[model samples]
Target chain A: MVSLILSTAVRYIFPLQLLFSIFLLLRGHNEPGGGFVGGLVVAAAFSLVALANNVWTAQRTMGVNPRVLIGVGLLAAAVSGLQALIAGQPFMTAAWIARDIPVLGKVGTPLLFDFGVYLVVIGVTLTIIFTLMEE
Target chain B: MMQVNTVMNIWIVLPILIPLLTAVGAVLAWNWRRVQRVLSVIGSAALLGAGLKLLLTVWTDGILALQIGSWPAPFGITLAADLFSAIMVVLAGLLAVTVTLYSLASMDMERESFGYYPILHILLMGVCGAFLSGDIFNLYVWFEVLLIASFVLLTLGGERAQLEGAIKYVTLNLMASALFLAGVGVLYGIAGTLNMADLAVQLAKMEHPEIVTAVSMLFLIAFGIKAAVFPLFFWLPASYHTPPVAVSAIFSGLLTKVGVYALFRVFTLLFVHNIRYTHTMILIIAGFTMVTGVLGAVAQTEFRRLLSFHIVSQIGYLLMGLGLYHPAAMAAAVFFMVHVVLAKSTLFLVSGVVHWLQGTYDLKKLGGLYASAPGLALLFLIPALSLAGIPPLPGFFAKLALVGAGLQLGQYVISAVALAVSILTLFSMIKIWNEAFWKPQPLAATCASAQPVLLIIPIVLLALVILGIGFFAGPLFTLAARAAEQLSDPAGYIQAVLGGA
Candidate 1:
């Protein structure tokens, strides 16, 4: 019932894909990668985990319910836009940190918005995939 | 200078943003069905308040335009609300609140646990976004968002009938979306702009007027299907009655009207270059849509199916206002839209209550409503009479506004058709009354007891609003007139959005 080679390979591939997805999410504002792409990567990673072993293993790997991710992602995106309104600007007007903050240099609302998108993409894709696979 | 105005425009975004946030909140509370319910209700109330503030701001401060990300005009995503869009957004909020309330009593927990409230709020977000979007492409994006939510809502329980309806519904809507996108792409290719105000400006200066006219036809076909105009309306009656009646109420109330609103917006704003041809074509379509829809209703014995057919006919009336292309006619169209949303949704809710009680939607299997539940009968009468254009009801005034405009414009043939359709509409309403309420009980066991007070509250409140609009038609008419003025002459709209471009 188990494929040793594939499951072992997935252990390495899954974490690598997740790390790369985070990199894409962080670098999205200045580079080719963004939340949507990164989210897809993460989703792909989980799907690979499911394929290599079974959906139950992948479900356990994704610790939280996928719906929670969707909600959090949407809230983050909406709240990022509201920051502009709170700062006496029109809603969704990009506001940025003037100084560099640790490893993330010059954070902005767009990146936050993109992060939300990443989560939503991951949440939605995983939920659909997991539900269908489980069925 | 523009920076100062952006701050004032913050409220303009709330109508869209509130729903988005509400959708998120509802989703987050997915594990707790009660929390999702509370979130939808409170969020919709906030939406209503925000819509009213936005309407007041637009009324006093003129049009408010917001450029997302602080991008400059003609280049950024623009959300502009004139009086018309403001009114629509407010009405949408009202629909949201009432439907959410209705869902409290009507929706089963099985559906609730499936993220119904979240999906509903997401649908509202799409609606508000579509209304506020000043960019045509942005409107398409919002349409997709709402359509996806609707697809989920339509088949949430996966009933066999729902799957059948959903298949036809999604297939047709997807076709319409493709057509609309193709039209938008061509329009962008021609004008090199997606901002509606900018498109209007650029369209005026284009060398090829004929190309613009052809592009206008593309918009007409695209919106025509979505509007469920004649020859493309089979999908509506096929799918609308399949969903939970709360879902049906919102769909019947708002969905097709979006198509109508878009047609009115684009035609009056951008496609005025070929009024003689396009308007005439719209007028002809309006006439057929009315006749065919009413004729279809006369044949349906089931309750919701008849109402579904009436929705198609009513679209014809709204389109007639558009086809007439007069300021008064456009104002009438706006007024008519508000009336239909309230009255039609109330009717659907009433149907929901009846179905909940009687366990069937078939008219033949229903009787003794007047005998068993006279109060429900009376509540139903308010909207039904209003729908039939009876005196002292909003429907009467709505029809008067449209017919008056039609006759004033000297379009006698369409005017005659409009009058004929109203009488036919009355005939069908009377038919329903005779069959469902007035007739004696055909079976004693099938008689429905009194409905829950909570369900009746929405019906009564909506009826009261219909009555309120009827009695206080003066201010509302004035507002509709102002909105029509902006549509016919977009100088105010273009000035506000483009800032002297």
Candidate 2:
């Protein structure tokens, strides 16, 4: 099922798609782009690689296990919510920083939450894809 | 107010967090069998502890509501616990602890190591979330969470029968979910908010009741299927008996009960404008559900399959209590929920232990438990008798209260039907006793060598709880009556959530 041309094209295309996904995530604070959309884009990037080459190659390229990503992502999202307990807000209250960081812009727990959503989406999407493809 | 709520609300949140964190721990330690197993016990116990505390807090402190992210009512995702929700949380936690312990002996290592424990805990998280959530949309999310987890548990072993059952289970449930989402959308369109409290307030002042009535039907059918009542229960008898007994035990305990919980919650709180039309319809359905369910059980030859039919039958009684709408009846209904959850799950766990020993769930091929294993016979008899509504057991008291309430109102037909169904329930339970335990030992039966004490422990623990409920029926009924009173009037619940609106 592999095509040399598809594989060659995906090598360059995948990184760009990932960068775009991160961009979507960053712009999510006050814009249409957010965790869900950004996560879909990243999943699409990896899926493209899987389509061009194969699942094992894509797995190696991704570096971390999809399930581990889910675990870490959930932990991050939960932590982002619970961090509010320290600030004396209710659980999941969006605590924010008054200053901006480079590339990420003004930081907050919501952004961390978004990032967590991003990773979970990628993990879940790929796991489903990989399982179906293998079957 | 926010400061006070922040401290008070952790009880609401901890039930959910404990499971989520434990599932995370299991996933992170994916290959570490010992850690995952240990986490399962400790996590489930923590949930139980948290639920008990939450129950006490709600009992003494009155109903508690928390607006997540500090958003005001009608806007934020709210978590609230009246007595009803608290009771459900405690039941779920208890089921979790028992089922998790049972899985340690009954479930195979392959299934356990293949992410079973983690998914099971996630299922618990979803159940707790569903119980505590105070918004319609959030309830849907929790429903999906539990749905997804149950789907995995249903198909965990990937057997042919499991896949077949999973298809029916998932397809019907997904269809029901679609209807539920559509109902939520239409409801939000009409009421302009997703919070249940706000909807209640807005809906009470609604001018045209037809649209609301129509929306109410959509919810009724949606939850009806989940509750597996009357004609909507084709999926229950098909899929429930196919899962590993441990999965069946938890699903039997918590899943349908959640559906029943939602039905009563909405009927009491959200859709009280037209009781004559809605409650009467519910009553009719409840009667049919009872008759059809017991009749189905009488025809089943398999142990778990037979019990599965009884699940449908028992659900009819809960709906009957709801339909009656008497305070005493509703209190009896709550007590019935507590009894059934403990008793039914224990029944499934016993079935698992039987299969572990006899190597089959087919009632035809099994016999002689009475002579061979008196302890197991006693364990099975406790729940089976309670389920049949025998005296001195919780089931008997539940039936007496419900029938008493119906007869008091001169609803003679349903009352007669209720008494008749109790007789049939006893008939089938005795049928099982005669066939599987009381009769002579079959020629081909070879009892397994190792009767894992692990399998017996949960059954024994739950059996004691059943007896305890029976012995303490007076206080339990008093508490249930108090809960029923609170449910009958939603004003206090609304006040607790929305503040001095």
Candidate 3:
């Protein structure tokens, strides 16, 4: 019963951490934190959830397997790189936008690449932890 | 400036994206083996198609660049494909298809239940991303992606050897990563921009000889560790042999080449002005790498271990070409990279078949497989000979190109060492043939069902590719030459990246 209450509180914290990770990634371009660190933060959150719940249960709740997360992350990152090609620039040349929107107006591929970073960290960390847990 | 946009731009991204999406689908379908198989096959096929299409596009266009979010050069992340990157993508795609097919046939269904295809796809994505990325820092990110996937795959089975190997692999690679970051940091501090083309322009303007040497050395060490160059390669043979054949095949084919690609990129573009210092170091390293690597191979008793050692030795040949810094030498490196990928992967696949039949990779315990699996033996023989640089095989032409270039550059010692290494390579192949195929079947040899046709198909296909490159050397050599020329002349590459004519 106590475990159930703790699990509920942990679940509430998870989304908050994920949001913070995204914030870190977005603000990383000129700041100390970036996609790689932000991704690790997200992975750490998922890892905590896995530790609290069973690996299988946490995996199910993830809605996608860790490996797939890695794949998607890689895809997202590659697509971010491709954005340069589409604009007739060289490979991995960074592109951006600085528009005035109410909320997140100045979003760009760097942030997209950061999202990819988040996915990879989560996928890789979970894969290592879960695979070890199985052993 | 005139702009030309084509569907080929989409093709450039698909090789990386398809596997990534399929990996996700595989995980979601983890409970359903049939769905996983279908998704992997479809994804791999799509990647294959994309790779071929991109190759054709690059052949015609000279180089293709894609700007993310419609951002212009020097400011945006780009995925650019020159002839070299395009060919690497095609090679990787083909290898992925074959390895996936082999995995489908070879992997135990029960053990593979936990999203194996997903991991495979992600690994392929990392490789494809590394190949297509145009920025130095972006390349580092992709390297991490590839390394992490490979780490998972290495430890997938959770065996003691796998765990041990994974630890070493991860530890060594992590060190490489740290070094890579340090190198990037130094380069960034020196040049201001992390994009390869932009760095090239900035580096061209810097006239400080000491700073240039220091930065190049840093890059050399970082890429050297990844490429498994001499003194940094002890971890490779130990770890590579622990994985399943499909995993080993892909790792052997794609992983080290990423390092080679980085070396080729940096040396030809950013550090071209200081060829005397950098190229001379490359020459010495290449010589030691060749001598020690082949010597390590000669000492190995296990098939996979021996092959892993050869991987190091072969890297020497690639670096040798880079050391020469001649157009012909660079062409030779390109040709050799393709040849090594095909030959090494084929050899690993054949070893897989042998292990499947005999349940051992030890030379002493194996014999007489030729009678039971003549087809498998023949499949192994072609790539073995190709790797040994036998005449009429692509490996021979690759070696010939390097040697010819070395001779022209008057690096007689390097040319001579190249020939000596070829002889040693042949000796190593003979050792395998003698122990695994030509020797009498041990009385303890256990028989298994006729070799799985799926596994053999990919091995045979790769062997045929080796032969095809050998037969059609003229056009491919010309292509490689063009790539070398383009890489050597960084003006176009820089212009494309910096949005300047």
- lDDT minimum window of 10 residues, candidate 2 chain A: A81-90
lDDT of 2 by residue, B70-182 (tens): 88888888998999899999999998889988988888888988899999999999999998889999999999999999999999999999999999999999989999999
Give the CA lDDT, 0 to 100, for residue B35 in model 2. Answer: 96
DockQ of 1: 0.83
CA error at residue B130 for candidate 1, angstroms: 0.6
Question: Using alpha carbons, what is the TM-score of model 1?
Answer: 0.98
Residue range A32-129, candidate 3, lDDT tens digits: 87888888887777777776776677677778768767768867877786687666654455677777445554577877887788788888788888
What tens digits encode model 1's per-residue C-alpha lDDT throughout B120-191? 988888888888899999989988998898999999999998999999999999999999999999999999
Candidate 1 lDDT over residue span A1-135, tens digit each = 678999999999999999999998888888898899999999999999999999999989999988899999998898899898888887888888888788776699988899899999999999999999998
DockQ computed for model 3 against the true two-chain complex using alpha carbons: 0.26
Residue B261 Cα positional deviation in candidate 1, in Å, after optimal superposition: 1.0
Candidate 3 chain B has its poorest 10 consecutive residues by lDDT at B1-10
Best by lDDT: 2
Chain A TM-score vs. truth, each candidate: 0.95, 0.95, 0.82
TM-scores of all predicted structures: 0.98, 0.98, 0.87
Number of backbone clashes in candidate 2 = 0
For candidate 2, give the DockQ.
0.78
Model 3 - which docking category? Answer: acceptable
